[model samples]
Target chain A: MTSLYWAVADGWTITRRDLTHWVRQPTPIILGLLFPIMLVLMFGFLFGGAIAVPGGGDYREFLLPGMFVMTVAFGVEGTMIAVTTDAARGVTDRFRSMPMAQSAVVVGRNGADMLDSVLVLAAMIGCGLAVGWRWHGGPGATLAAVGLLLLLRFALLWVGIYLGLVVGGPETVAAVQILVWPIGFLSNVFVAPETMPAWLGTVAAWNPLSATVSATRELFGNPGWGGQSWIAQHATVMAVLWPLAIIAVFFPLSVRAFRRMSR
Target chain B: MSVVAEGLHKCYRDKSALDGFDLTVAEGRVCGLLGPNGAGKTTAVRILATLLRPDGGRAEVAGFDVTRHPAEVRRRIGLVGQHAAVDEVLSGRQNLVMFGRLYHLSSARARARADELLTQFGLADTGDKAVKQYSGGMRRRLDLAASMILAPKVLFLDEPTTGLDPRARNEVWAATRALVADGTTVLLTTQYLDEADQLADDISVIDNGQVVGNGTPDQLKTKIGGDRIDLVLHDADDLAAAAATVSRVTGADTDIDRDDRRLSAPVRNRVAALVEASRALDDAGIAVEDIVLRRPTLDEVFLTLTSAGTGHGPRETGRE
Candidate 1:
């Protein structure tokens, strides 16, 4: 029981250390929050006119849920950069040398990053409202949509941490940032999958991001591609299952990767 | 003994970092590991710190086997690596407190310990500044302060003052001396022979992944030779006469440099050799520019031992 308590305490201290960074250097956090706002305006107004939703509704409304998923997905790179920087700077080694719980660093990193995702999600949601995006569903369904988005963020957090440990240092971190884009655009975020070629459309529809976006769009009562595919019909199940599956695989993988660093 | 290692070996791909390395550090004394680059000093440290496992052999630190009881060894040791392992974004006090908390100190105790360390390491004035704004010396001092938080039985410092200015190096030296006074056994690896001379009670000269020589600083210095009388002649023509006079007086092999007009010869007794050489030069009418009796430095000892194969030659005066 005391060991469990100490883990939580150590994890909270690490989380607080990251929180101090947010307070001391607000520029990066502010810039990170503002980048998505810029994207919302660009895609909602500049490019929204050219793009069409399959089932006619406001383009901003259709784009908002997709952007929400994109904003969370984008967090993967930021988390990876932070982890790799710590590893390169020897902070990871310092923590490893100490008598603290081995899992505290990852737990703390995930905890602080989850908090960051919440703040980013809230800001993107505000940006969505300003651009005339709305959800016709009741409070419970709306809350469920937000929960699904965070779940996806939590799952991707492990992936980011794992990759950060595998590809150490800043240069390799910049290289891994390139992967986030394909994972982002190759989903249902920017365009309806049905708009692409049949094979490409299937790939997009099956993306994990697509599951969260499609599920949230359904809950928000917003217009989406009314595909007759079974995956589209069961978006909510896939939404929960996909993240759980990712967590199951990547969580252990990330912890093992972290342990392997000492070797 | 606080640390013990025997026949330790480690290999990296096609390179051998440690080949039959051995070390033993007694309680409450500093054991310096002197070596050039790629000499396996760091590999030995990493193994003892429980950060890496050796491919072969056995080691114990603080009464626990490093491989079988890493957690126990970790609990009793502190390691300060080459680079400062500190958060640049956090203040010195915050960094120290965070480390204290991670060591399981209570909030109140952690804060108190941070303040104490800040004052002890002369960081009290700038404890609130972000570490990014700190000078390199201050950052290193803070790094040292961080490692001392737990007051472990043993501490490992890898090149603690490798890049510091002389004054900052003295500051770290003083801090290390203070730690020794408090009874912490330190194992320091350094490339600076003078650093080992100043701080170490005993030094193990490592080269090519093995201990080529080990002894007290004075013993290592005496390995190359004893005190020597150096004479610089005022005139180039006086070189041979000065060398002949010093050889006749000390009855030792004299090394003469023609261009510099300098003659040096090994001496058994420093003051007697100096007096006798002065009288001999006066009798020969050799105009002496300067003459002094000097001892061999650790630099010469290191060069002789490392360059001399097997380090078991007749010139290798000290062993064990």
Candidate 2:
């Protein structure tokens, strides 16, 4: 019982350290919040005019829900950058050498990043409301949609931590940043996958980001591709399952990586 | 012993970082692990600090086995790595408080300890300034403050003053001395022989991942040779004559440098040898320009021990 208490206390202490960074240096957090807003405007105004929804529905509504999920997906880069910076700077070794609970470093990082994701989601939601996007579903479904987005963010957090532990330094994080774009665009977040070639569209439909995007579109009562595929029909179940599966795989990998840091 | 390691071994892929490494540091004493780059100095420190586990052998820190009871070891030990490990974005005071809190101090106590350490390390004036704005010396002092929050029984410093200017290096050395005065057992790894000569109670010379020599500074200097007398002649042609005179007076072999018109040889009695060599050189009409008798320095001891059979041969000292 005493050990468990210290674990939580130590984790919160590390989380507070990151929170202090937000207060001391707000520019990075402000820029991270602003990037998704810029993407929302660029897509909703520039590409929304020429694009057509699968059936008859507004593209802004379709784009807004996808933008929320995309915002959550992009959080991996921030987590990776923070983790790799700590490792390179020797801060991680200091933590490891301390008497604090062993699991607190990664756990605290996840907690702080999840909080960042929530703030980003809240800002994107406000941006959506300003640009004339509404949820026809009641408050309960909207809350579930937000939960699904966060669930995806939580799973990706482990992946970021694992990669950060494995990667050599911050220079490699830039390559990971560039790779995020291709994976982000390959999903159905920007457009209906049906508009692409058949093989490409199928691949996009199977992307984990697409699962959250499709499920959240249904929850928000927004326009979607309205495809007849089995995966689309089961978007909500896949959304929940995909992130759980990711957590199952990457969480252990992350813990193992942290433990093997001595090697 | 506050820290002990027996035949510690670590390998990185095909390369061996530490092989058959052994060390023991007693309580309340500073032991300097002196070695050049890639001699496994940092590797041995890491293993004892519980940051890395050796693939073979056993180690203990503060009476706890490093691998089996790392938690216990960590609770009693502190580590200051090669880089300043404190947070750059945070102020010096904030970094200390955060580390204090992680050491499980209560909020009020953490703050009080932070203030105390800031004052102690000479960082009280800059305590509120962001560490990024502080000088390199200030950052290193802050790093020391962070590690000392718990008044750890044993502290590990890995190359604490590698890049600092002479003054900053002195500041760090003073801080380390203060810690030792408080009964903290310190294991410091350094490449600078002067640092070891100044701070270490006992110096261990590591070469090729093992200790080549271990003794006090004076003892190690004596192990290589006793006091030596050096003479610089007025003319290059006098080098041969001076060498013969000095060797005969000192009863030792003389090394002659024709380029510098210098000759040096070891002596059993420093003053007697100096007096006899001056008279002998004067009688031989060697025209000696300068002569002095001095103890062999730790640099000479280090080169003589580490440079054996490495093919580079022993280089000249006083180059730096």
Candidate 3:
């Protein structure tokens, strides 16, 4: 616990450093939100009303949940890429040489990525609001929606962190980016998972991304799977379980990879 | 003792980085680790610093086994790595304070330490400048200062001046001297032979993942003998003739540096080898362009000894 204390503190310091770099550079920060915003502009208007939402009337209403999922996807890969860059730049090697904490590297990276995810969520919510997509469930529902979104982001964060450790260098980080597109598209973000063909729908519904969005629609009293879905009734557990499953499986693996790399 | 390693064997997969490497550095002595590239000099330093674990054997720093009590080891050790650990985004002052905070020092103590280091390193005026704006010399000073933030008993410096300009290198040498004066022991690795000469109380030459030679600089130099006879000839043909003539007169080994037309060889005694090479060169019609005998350097000693053994002899040990 004491070791973790110094490590986490160090990690937070590194986060502040990373943030300062972003603040000074400003390019990546602008680029971070541009893709999501561009998607909001492109898809929100073009596909509005043409695609059916999971729980309700407006296609933009359905699109809001999808955008939230996209935000997590868009943000988490950046964490992985930044880690690979650190490895290539010898920053990671430099840290290892210091008397600083080892676990702090991962913990700090995850913590910083979480901060970015929050900013991404805010931008996404603002965009959704601008596009006439409303969160009718008010304050409690908004908090619940964000809670669900954070849970999913936490899960994806571990996966990205692990992938970052697994990938040897920066060049391979792009290959990891390919997985995000498929995972994001397959979820209930844009359309109801049940509405898809039998096999993909089953996968889409079971996927943690879809689980969060499905549970999110239930909180907002948004349309989801014709009111008969199993996910709607057990929404709270699914939301918590997804992050737990991700943390359990990937967290240790990432830690193990981190340990292996220290050699 | 501030640092001790006994039979540490570290292997990276199929490659061994440290094999039965051993050393003990007393408090307040600057121990220099000298070796060429690919030698395990950095590896030994890392293990002693508790940054790496050996597959076999043990190491202790400040009376704590590095593997078992890493936090304790960390508490008593400061490391200035070969590269600067300062975050480029942070200003010079911020970088020092960040390290201070990381060491769990109080705000006041951290600030005081930062100020002292800034004054000592000559970085006081540039405190507000982002590290990226500082010159190479400034960065090296800050790196040394950052390592001293907590004033640990032992400091590890891996190649403290590999790329620094001569003036900047001297600045670092002065900083290290100050640390050693204050009773801080240091373990340093360097490819520059002069660096070891300038700072080390004891020298260890690591080659091919093992300790080839370890002793005081004079002790290591003695392995190549006290003196060497250098004879430079005008023509390439004279080199071969001179070698045969000198080998007959004195039984010392001979080598002619191909590019420089410099013929160098071991001698039983400087005076004896000089007399012999001269008489032989004159007798064999070898025009000796220049001839001089002087004390061999650690560089010559390292080349002649350490014996990578292309079928030379058994591994010699203990300053022989």
Candidate 4:
């Protein structure tokens, strides 16, 4: 019990350290928050006219849920950049050398990034409201949707940590950032995958991001991709299962990568 | 001993970072691991600091086995790596306080410790400033201060002043000396031989991932040779004659510099060797332009000890 207490305390200290970074350099956080907002406005106004939702459903309602999922997915890059930068700077090594709990560093990183993800979700939701996006699902369903978004962000946290340790520097964060865009656009974030070629559409519909987007649209009582595919039919279950699967694979992988750094 | 390691080995692909490296550092004394690039100085320090596990052999630090009891070793030792590891976005005070907090100090105690270290390291004035604004020297000092948050029993500093100006180097040296004065055992690694001469109580000379030589700075200097008598003659024609005369007097092989019309030979007695060489060159009708006998610096010891013909590969002054 005492050991667990100290681990939490140590992890909280590192989280606070990251929080202080947010306070000290408000530019990056503000810019990061602005990025998704800019995307929402761009896709909603500039590109929304071109994107036709089937049955003439409201594009804003369909796009908002997908946008929330994209916002959460985009978090992977920031976490990767922060983690790799710290590793390159040797701060991670410094923490390893100290008498702190082994998991504290990663735990603290997840905590801080999750907090950032929450703020990001709040900002995107506010932007959605401004752009005439509304949810007809009651409060419980809305809460579940928010919960799913956070879970996806949490799972991506481990993926970012693992890749950050593997890459070992900030220079590669840009490469990872570039890869995130294709993943974002390939899913149901903008156009319904069904509009693509049948094979390509199947791949996109199976994408983990698609599951979260599809599930959240259902929870938000918004328009979703109308498909008879098993993945689309089981979107709600897949939403919870996909993040859990990601966490299971990458959590240990990330911890192992972190250990391998000193070796 | 605060630390001990034997036959520790680490291989990174084709390069052996630590090859049967051995070290022993007595309590409350600074032991400098002197070496050039790729000499395993950093590798050895990392292993001892509980950051890396050696591929072979055994090690103990601060009475805990590094591989088996890393947590305990970590508690007793502080490591300041080759780079300044403090958070760049955080203030100096915040960085130190964060480190203290990670060590499980209460909030108030952590704050107090941060202030104390800031004052001790002469960073009090700029403690509130973001670390990104700190000069390189200031960052290094803060890095050192952060490592000492718990007043660790053993401190591992890997090239603490590698890229600092002489003035900044002196500041770090002063701070290190103060730490030693408080009975903190230090293991400092450096390419600068003079840094070891200034700070290390005992010096370990590493080359090719092994301890080629180890002793007090003076003792290692003696291992290479005693004072050297350097003679610059007026004409290149007199070089051979001067070399023979100096060799005859010192009973050591003389190294010649044809461009400078110079020859130098190691000698046991400083003043007597200088006077004797001067008289011998004068008698041989060799017009001497300059002659001096000076004690061997650590630079010469490192050169002689790590030179290609002596032990390692072709001499490449790591500075270049």
Candidate 5:
């Protein structure tokens, strides 16, 4: 029990270290928050006119939840960069050498990233509202939609931490950062999968981001492609399962990678 | 012993980083692991610090086996890696307080410890500045301060002054000496022979993953040879004549450097050898500009010890 207490204490300590970074250098966080807002403005104003909603609804409303998912997905890049930087700078080794709990580093990182996700999600929601995006499904469903977005963020956090540990050097991290964009664009986040070719549509519809986007669109009472496919019909179920599956795989992998470092 | 390792071996795929490495550092003394790059100094230090497990070896730090009781060993040992490991975004004091918190000190204690370390490391004036704004030496001092938060029983410093300027290196050396004065056992790895000579009470000279030589700095220097006589002749043409005269007087082979018009040879008696060499060179009309007797430097000791195929020659000088 005492050990468990210290482990949590150590994890919180690490989390605070990251949070302190946020306080010391607010530019990156501000830029991260602004990037999604810029996307919202570009797509909502400049590009929303060209894009059509399949079910005949406001394009901004349809695009808002997708933007939220994209925001969460984009978080992988930040997490990866942070992790790799720490590893490269020998901060991770310092933590490993200390008597702190073995799990504390990752746990603290997850905690900080999750907290950052919450703040970003809230800011994005405000951006959504200012752009005339509204959820007709009332407060509870909106809360559920927000929860689904954070759940996806939580899952992708582990993926980021895992890849960060696996890939060495800043150059490799830059490549991975570039790779995240295609994965984000290939999903149903920006455009309906039905607009693409049949095979490409299937792949996007099955994307983990698609599940959360489709599910949150439903909970928000916003228009989506509303496909008749079984996977499209089960967006909420997949939203929960996709992140759980991700956590199941990458959590252990991240822990194992941290332990096996320099061995 | 505050730290001990025996037959520690670590193989990274086809390359062996450490092969049968062994060392022991007694309490409150600095043991310098002196070696050139890739000589397994860092690898040996890592194993003793409980950061890396040896493939085939037994090691202990602060009475706890590194592999078996890593957490216990970690509690007693502090490691400062080659690079400065403190966070760049945080201030110097913040980094120390964060590390102190990770060490499980209470909030107030962590804060107090941070203040104490910042002052001790001479970082108190810059304690509130973001680490990114600090100079390289200040960052390194902060790294050292972070490791000293718990007043660890054993401290592992891997190439602490590898890239610092001479003055900055002196700052780190001074800090290390203060730590030793406070009774912290330090296991320092450094490539600079002078760094070892300045700070190490004992040194283990590593080469190709093993201790090639180990002793006090004076003892290691003596292992290569005793005092030597050097002559810088006034005329370059006298180099050959001076070498012969010095060798004849010292009864040892002389090293002749025609470019510098210098000749040097090992001698048993410093004063007598200098006198005899000066007299013989003067008799031979060598036109000696200068002659002096000096002890063998640690660099020569290192070169002679680690030169390939000098197998077990220098090893005999190490503690058995």
Candidate 6:
């Protein structure tokens, strides 16, 4: 009820409004959860026979971690579009004039999107387990991997908020989504970077999303590079470092752009 | 409480938005800024609101310098910008509560204020509806309510009544009257001369990035003097003779302008001049097309000062 309490409630109230908007449709979020499920069905049944898990386990096991990271990448686009819509509709301008802490608006909305991301992650993982995927590692390590994916999602949402703020004009934002899909697929989410060409392997390894996926694969005890490179041995390090680095770089940038928006 | 600015200068490349603009408003009073679009009225309001920093000069609101102590100034002032400032995705009641919460009010207090504002604006029935569903006037009223939640000592309303129907404008005017009655100092910029005339106790007329005039409505009206007479004649040749007759008899400057119209300079006696002018025009066989006598409106005063037609000196210099 105090001022700080208001600050907390302010963020969630804004977030809840978006939740209500999504609840009205329930299609996009449902589809995001379903698209990866469809991928799991096609790859597990159709292509599982030829795929190799490198003497680790079933193809579904390897694919689950990849799909989780892919969902994070795909979900960033939704956040980007939402931010763009808010900007285009003059909702962002309306927020600027109020006495509200400017950063809380974007932060609160992203926090709301994170709720959707968590639900989608849980449902996708549920469908994966319903098939033949197994987590050899203990539940503790499994929880840690889930932690990494959420951090990655949170980090990427801020980046999307910044991108949305940068491209203030909305018409071109959707066109820019085409560029995002390629970047999401090019990372080590679906295939090991070693299988890619040498130049692409380098790019795949350095991708921030790759850090989380590579880290998740190890934590799940499924399949990874297995200490062939520094990232394989230090996946946990990269998992934490990448999201922190993104937050460090993008958080203030978003807030500064927001403050200067009204100025 | 008071907003005082001196030597304020702001510019946009190749165009000056504010040219050494100066404004002074004492505490607990409603000050209206009347000007056409692009007159730098909004620019001055933004500077006072701390939403903008002047390229030069200084401004203070409630004893805090706008540029140096912008946060302090912001805490003391509220701004309802030209564009409505409510989140359209949120309901009208939610919008007010959100702003109230932003001002650090408790949830119960915020909700109370939201309900109060909704009822005050006649929006209680539609309080649960999203702002996008509300008419332009309703959204505008909500925008006003958002700025007023803090009961700020200084409120900046930038073009508050623009694009509203007459009834909606009256609603906003009523709100303004109520706010001023409650001892909230207001500084509003408007292109609607009538709104300013009705709501503002003190009027400041800005033109081309400068203050052309400032006063109470009655003072400004008196400064412009009595009603004017303009006539249209049937033909140019006949109009010129009519112009000669009227000018000689009334000793008023008369000219046969375009469209065979004659403009007779100020006449204190409208009835006497209308009868004499009509009689002379009739004798000259110049049929009178139309005749009208009316007080000089704010529009005319604005046109005169800003359009370079009057050739009068600085509007405030000789008057004060």
- Which CAPRI quality tier does the interface of model 3 achieve? acceptable
Among these predictions, the greatest DockQ belongs to 4
Q: What is the C-alpha RMSD of each candidate to the true structure, in Å?
A: 3.5, 3.0, 3.5, 3.2, 2.7, 4.3
Which lDDT value does model 2 have at B151?
92
User: Which parts of model 4 are misplaced by more than 4 Å?
Assistant: B269-272, B307-320
What TM-score does candidate 2 reach? 0.94
- Candidate order by TM-score, decreasing, is 4, 5, 2, 1, 3, 6
What are the per-residue Cα lDDT tens digits for candidate 2 across B1-320? 99888998899898898889888888998999999899999989988888898999899899999999999999999899999998889999999999998999999999999999999999999999999998888888999999999999999999999889888888999999999899999999998999999899999999888888888999988887777788889999878778888888877778777777877787888889989999988888778889988887787788877854243322333221
- What digit string (tens of lDDT, one per residue) describes model 4 on residues A1-263? 38899889888888888788888889988998898889888888889999998657888888999989888888999899888888888998999898898889988998899999988899889999999999889999999999999999999999999998898665688888888889988888899898999999988999999999999999999998778889989999999999999999999999789878777
Looking at model 2 chain A, which ten-residue stretch has the lowest summed lDDT? A168-177
- Candidate 2's docking class is high
Interface RMSD of 1: 1.0
Candidate 1: the clashing residue pairs are none
Q: Residue A90 CA error for candidate 5 (Å)?
A: 1.6
lDDT per model, in order? 0.88, 0.89, 0.78, 0.88, 0.88, 0.77
Model 6 per-residue lDDT tens digits across residues B95-135:
88877877778889999999999998889999999788888
Model 5 scores what on Cα lDDT? 0.88
lDDT of candidate 1 over B1-320, digit per residue (tens): 99999999999887999999989999988999999899999999989988888999999999999999987888888888888889999999999999999988889999999999999999999999999999878988899899889899999999999889998899889888988899999999999999999999999999988999888999887776777777889999888778788888888767777777878777887888889899889988989999988887787678777753332222333332
lDDT of 2 by residue, A28-113 (tens): 99999899999989999998899888896899999998888878878998899888888888999999999999888987898899
Candidates, DockQ: 0.68, 0.82, 0.40, 0.85, 0.79, 0.34
Full candidate order by DockQ, most accurate first: 4, 2, 5, 1, 3, 6
- Could you give the DockQ of candidate 1? 0.68
Sequence-dependent TM-score of model 1 = 0.90
